[model samples]
Target: MPLLHKIAGVVVVCAVVLGLTLPAHRRGAEKESPAGRVGNSSSAAPAAKVSGSPAPSGSPTASATPLKPIPAAAPGAAAVKANELGQIPVLMYHRIVPKPEMSLDRSTKELYDELTRLAKGGYVPITAAEFVSGWINVPAGKHPVVLTFDDSTPGHFALDAAGRPKADTAVAIIQRVAAENPGFRPVATFYLNKELFGMADAQAAAGLRWLVQNGFELGNHTVTHPDLSGMSEDGVHKEIGGMEDRIVQLAGRHTTTFAYPFGAVPRKGKWARKDGSRYSFQGIFLAGWRPSVSPFADEFDRWNIDRVRSEGKIKENDCTKYCSTAWLEYLDKNPDERYTSDGDPNTVTFPKTAEDRLAKEYRRRARTY
Candidate 1:
């Protein structure tokens, strides 16, 4: 059997044992609630210690060095307050496809059922901004869920093998759920990269416009989706600025949020160029750089906000299987942990093994509790 299958089997066995051993009330608490309750204050301390490098304080032009003993706050508190009553989780998704071969991606039916389940569970969907701004404060007993789609693939908007928007089934389910329950208005964020527009057969350009018109927010995922750390100042500007330009032209809106491709900085610093170099020119123009590893400072970078990537199979019946409410709860209780990359921002290091990837996942999930 494959590693994921083995891991899945282990999870199943563990879940069964956990279910049987846990107290009845606790078991009920663990019974895959509609959504994990987000606490108003994060119990976990800041992940990284801000260095005392005497860097310019609070200036966009400050050096990009990690600070030590950084002021620790509740997890995600700087970006958005923890849901005091309980919060709606912002789930991240990359692609949705029908073919079984694309296990990494989800099918339309699966996506539809997932939304239907959220609706049935009384989970309200909110936008990423709403989650960050701490607005739309949901009271206790009210469940909220945020849906995000990354990579802006054409398959998301078009039919598969047939002639339909690939995400039509899922979108329909979301729209239906939203319409049926006024309080359950579901919102999704699309992190688009301009390069992906013409790669596929479908007219993705037009589809993006359609998504925005229909009430979805278009977010920036950088122009070419390259690691920004190693790139010179100029390179960063082009990567970010270029995409912002395209998003405005296509979606008729300027994007404030960005998703880091591969989710880490480079190590070798090949992408880094001198401040005056042509490549450096782009970086100089960019509003700022957001490093995912530095959750403390990164959250303050409104233009380059950090996000936790949701991985594994996302089924309507088992949305929490990969990232359960229990796990998120655990993260909420322990906030010092943050996601990190192989090297500094310029030169990046990719995960070398399944263990490495799992470790990364474990760390990312640790914050949600």
Candidate 2:
């Protein structure tokens, strides 16, 4: 109990605190593909205006805030046989109308039923950004599903007078289904174009802000939904960057994902995922017919993720083979081929026989049991 002993204790405590405050550098962070950068002849578009009547009072500007990190898996046997190297169904929808008009459209009832089925089947929704970022966090024994709505149609989202989502819209349906079924995360990514859900200038802003404020995601679908396959690289950049700037202006946040208009990529496909002055897309999606490969799988392609149409066995659109209903049934019968999580995000778990199927970059965190 000497004065010198007290001074030594204080110094040791200070040193420990300083060490804990220092940043820990991470090793082997994923590197962007060395794809050729596309030229951006277009300047950043003017900031969008979100002010108007019926705006949510004191809405916070959408800034880049990190999502709540999921805690590590608790100690116990994993509820499901983990297969981090399996396929994931990224369901795609266009219009959700009271009555289906186009082959790609689904009625409100159909949408509800499909979502109910997914919930009952042990699937949890995640944003397209999260899926492409390999941040699939769901409870153990649950499969991650990405529900993407393209074209930003009026049937997707709307705000009622009381700032509630319209009852029959996709947003409301999702929220209702989630309420009825516990553990069903009511989140999805809506890719937007110039139409902005066919709303007036100011009302559109309120809707966009609402989506971001809630758990939904805003993604780039171009200023105009044109088939990029016919456009030059500069045109592609303009389309992508223009939408990115508009999203930042309206939502006050940048979009991490981009869905190709009509799923048509430019002649130079690499430009779809390249970083420009106004935009940097982490993942680019395609209007594919089947489910996407797990983001951690060796065959996964971040720039060209696939999505199954939200339809049943129908010959009208040739979706009989690879639509949502068919794919979900297939997964049900062949559960081992689906991506079942191990609850822990830090470690990748799969069957020992599937070890070679995992991407080499993830081997350091791999666990085969």
As a TM-score, model 2 comes out at: 0.79
lDDT of candidate 1 at residue 119, scale 0 to 100:
66
Model 1: which ten-residue window has the lowest total lDDT?
Answer: 281-290
Q: Candidate 2 at residue 61, lDDT?
A: 34
lDDT of 1 by residue, 319-342 (tens): 444343333443345432322221
Clashes of each: 45, 1
**Which pairs clash (backbone N, Cα, C closer than 3 Å) in model 2?**
62-252
Name the lDDT value of residue 77 in candidate 1. 37
- Specify the poorest-scoring 10-residue window by lDDT in model 2: 38-47
Residue 186, model 2: lDDT of 97
Write the residue-wise lDDT of candidate 2 on 255-342 in tens digits: 8899998888899886777655678788889999989988887668787889999998988567677899999999999999999988
Index of the highest-lDDT prediction? 2
> Cα deviation of 37 in candidate 2 (Å)?
16
Candidate 1 structure, TM-score to reference: 0.49
